[model samples]
Target: MPFGGEPPQLLKQRLLYQGRRFSFESSRLRLPNEQEGEWECIRHPGGALAVPVTPEGKLILLRQYRFTVQGRLLEFPAGTVEPSEGPEETIKREIEEETGYRAHRWRKLGEYFMAPGYSDEIIYAYLAEDLELLENPPGQDIDEDIETTLMTVEEVDRAIHSGDLADAKSISAFMLARPFLK
Candidate 1:
C-alpha cells in the first residue's frame, strides 16, 4: 500500500489540548498494512513569515526566546494566522509589530510544512522589499522576548553555516528567498 494509506481513514480522534496558538490531537487510525495505533500531532492554524530586505541589502531578523528551546534563536518575523486573517495580512502585521518595518513590495516566496513529523503547521513565506522603518513601532506582545537586528546576506549565510542561526523555519524561508538575497 502507498504511504498514508491513500489518506488514512480517521478511526477516532480526540482533542488532547487546546492552546492559544495550536491544539493537540490524538487520532486512532487503521493503516493499510493492518496496523492500528494512535498518533498524536499538533493542529495549528498555520503561520506566515517574511524575509524583509532593506534597500541597502540587509535582512531583518529577530533573536527571540523560546521556552521550549530555552534560548534565543535568529528568526524572521512571523506570526500565527489568526482566525480572521490570511497569510498576507498576518505577515504584514507581524513585520511591523516584530521588526518595526513595513514593506511596500511583497513577493510571496512559497509555503512549507514546518514539522511534518508531529505538527500539521504549514508556514507561508514571503519576500518583503521596499522597506520603511516605522518611527513609532508597535509594542511587542507582553509575553514575547524579541530583539530585532539587521544582517547582510553574507552575514546571514555565515550565521547559518556556523549554526548560529538555527531556526528551521527561517532557514527554510531563507533558502526559498535565496535568489533574491544577493
Candidate 2:
C-alpha cells in the first residue's frame, strides 16, 4: 500500500531465460501513475543456511571457491531448497554434505532476501548446535569444492570486519544468529 494506492497492475510476464537453479523473467506493468513500464527479475527457489557451532564453541565454516566471485569465500554451510523441501530440511542436508557434521539441536535465526532489487532469493538462516562429526558422512555435492574451518566467535567478528568474510548471505546469517550464540 506504500507505493501510493493499489498494487501496480501486471500486464504481462515473459520468461527470458531458465537455468537449473533459477530463471529470469521480464514483466510489463502499469504503475500507480497509470504509466506502463517493464522490469526484469531473477526467480529462484531460495535457499537455507546454517551457522554451525560445536560443543567446544567453535564455529564451522566453509572456504569455497565461487566461480562468480572468482575467489574462495568463507561462508556458512548452505544450499538451495529443493522442491517440497523446507528450509530446515535443506540446511540439515547441506550441513552434513558440506561439513561432514550433523547437528542435534537447531534454532531459527532469521530470514532475508539476498538481493531484493534484482532477485527473489530468500535465505533462511539457522543456528545449529550439538554437532558431531560423522565417521563416514555423505560426500559433498559433485559440483562443490570446499574446505572446512573451525573459528572462534572472535575470529568470525574479526573476519567480518576485515572483509575476509564477504559473502552477503553468510554475513547476514551470522549477525542474525550472533545474539543467540555463546
Candidate number of the best TM-score = 2
Query: lDDT per model, in order?
Result: 0.93, 0.94
Q: Write the per-residue lDDT of candidate 1 for residues 41-126, one digit (tens) a residue.
A: 99999999999999999999999999999999899999999999999999999999999998999999999998999998999999
By how many angstroms RMSD does model 1 differ from the true structure?
2.4
* Model 2: worst 10 consecutive residues (lDDT sum): 1-10
Candidate 1 segments exceeding 4 Å error: 1-5
Candidate 2, 1-182: lDDT as tens digits: 02355888999999999999999999999987999999999999999999999999999999999999998999999999999889899999999999999999999988899998989899999999999999999989899999999999999999999999999999999999889888
| 128 Cα displacement, candidate 2 (Å) | 0.5
TM-score each candidate: 0.94, 0.95
| Model 2 / residue 10 / CA error / Å | 0.7
Angstrom error at residue 60, model 1: 0.6
How many clashes (backbone N, Cα, C below 3 Å) per candidate? Answer: 0, 0
